[model samples]
Target: MRPRLLFASAAAVVAALTAATAPSATGAPRAAAAAWDSDLAAAALSANPAAATASGSQSPELGPGAAFDGNGATRWSSNAADNAWLRVDLGETLRIDRVTLDWEAAYGKKYVLEVSGDGTNWRPFYTEDAGTGGTVTAHTYPQEVRGRYVRLRGIERGTPYGYSLFSFKIYGGTPAPASTTRANLALHHP
Candidate 1:
């Protein structure tokens, strides 16, 4: 049997995306913003490429846990072993509302989720004792909780050790104020 997500989260994600861009009462320029959900794992790259650089990630990548073995880099999982991570930089303060981790049936173990603004001061989001590969665990973060970066540490994988992945979605929260044309120009100038 194929593995499945712990929650019907994909549906919920699509719904949110639809709602955000639906339209407003003003009937003016409210601006279209990408919903936290939806099929945005790719679009997120364009929206925040610098974030990828900040997290040491590449394009078209779902989460952080890619094959970074070339540099002999040590991962959070095992030493000289199987493990991966998908860290994200929010670019600005955001009240992390929800998080979803998707993996393969091969990862029938467990792991941890941590968030931080300064990157040094960390806090645990959730610690699942058991995980079946192909499941997605969704958890609501503290409403007042805020951060600029999120690091998914695959501390442990399922029985048959390996990495499982598809994507990681950091759900809704308010984005910072609208950026002006002059500000955007200044940012590009170094």
Candidate 2:
């Protein structure tokens, strides 16, 4: 009886260690899921004025428009399908240097980030085969990817439900710095 008790305790310790290292149903580890990529990236270009669309919305309230509305409370959710996708159209063609995915509870296990100029022809800039699904920031510098339309094509769903995103933010050119000069140009009386 004493030996059985000792063996049970050893088994429990091994099980705990295995669970800690194993990938959860969410796809990646908890640490990677909680943080963004460590890089000083560019600002998001797909905010207001940008139109968003998707393959299929889970419901009227969870439309693709909610993803780019700049509201954390709102989100875009697709129907329960692995092929569901979300797309955003920047008003003009711009160099894409970074992208951030603020995923909801239902995330994508495998997805491809593509950019296109004509909206028909797409070129993948980033491919996420293993996603943990929290806030993922991807930098595409030196790849020279430029496009007006950016999209995330879901190849595999992380949850039984479809893919969902709070924000599908695209990043590009450097943001302008604030003026340091204290003198006001409009103050001239000449």
Top candidate when judged by lDDT against the true structure: 2
Q: Kindly provide the TM-score of model 2 when superposed on the true structure, using C-alpha atoms.
A: 0.66
| Candidate 1 local distance difference test against the native | 0.52
- Residues 1-190 of candidate 2 have per-residue lDDT tens digits of 2322112344664575477667889888632111123211112223343377789998999998888776789899999999999888775667777888999999999999999988899999999999989999878867888887889999999999999998877766422223212232123332
TM-score of each: 0.54, 0.66
* C-alpha positional error of residue 113 in candidate 2 after TM-score superposition, expressed in Å: 0.4
Worst 10 residues of 1 by lDDT: 67-76
- Candidate 1 local Cα displacement, residue 101, angstroms: 1.5
lDDT of 1 by residue, 1-190 (tens): 5553343345665675566576667765443564555423234444565453223322334224332211113221222223445566665556666776555444526567777888777787777767775647556644455677776666565755445455556676566444322343232211
Task: For model 2, state the Cα shift of residue 178 in Å.
Answer: 20
For every candidate in turn, the CA RMSD to the true structure comes to: 16.0, 21.6
Per-residue error at 128 for model 1, in Å?
Answer: 0.9
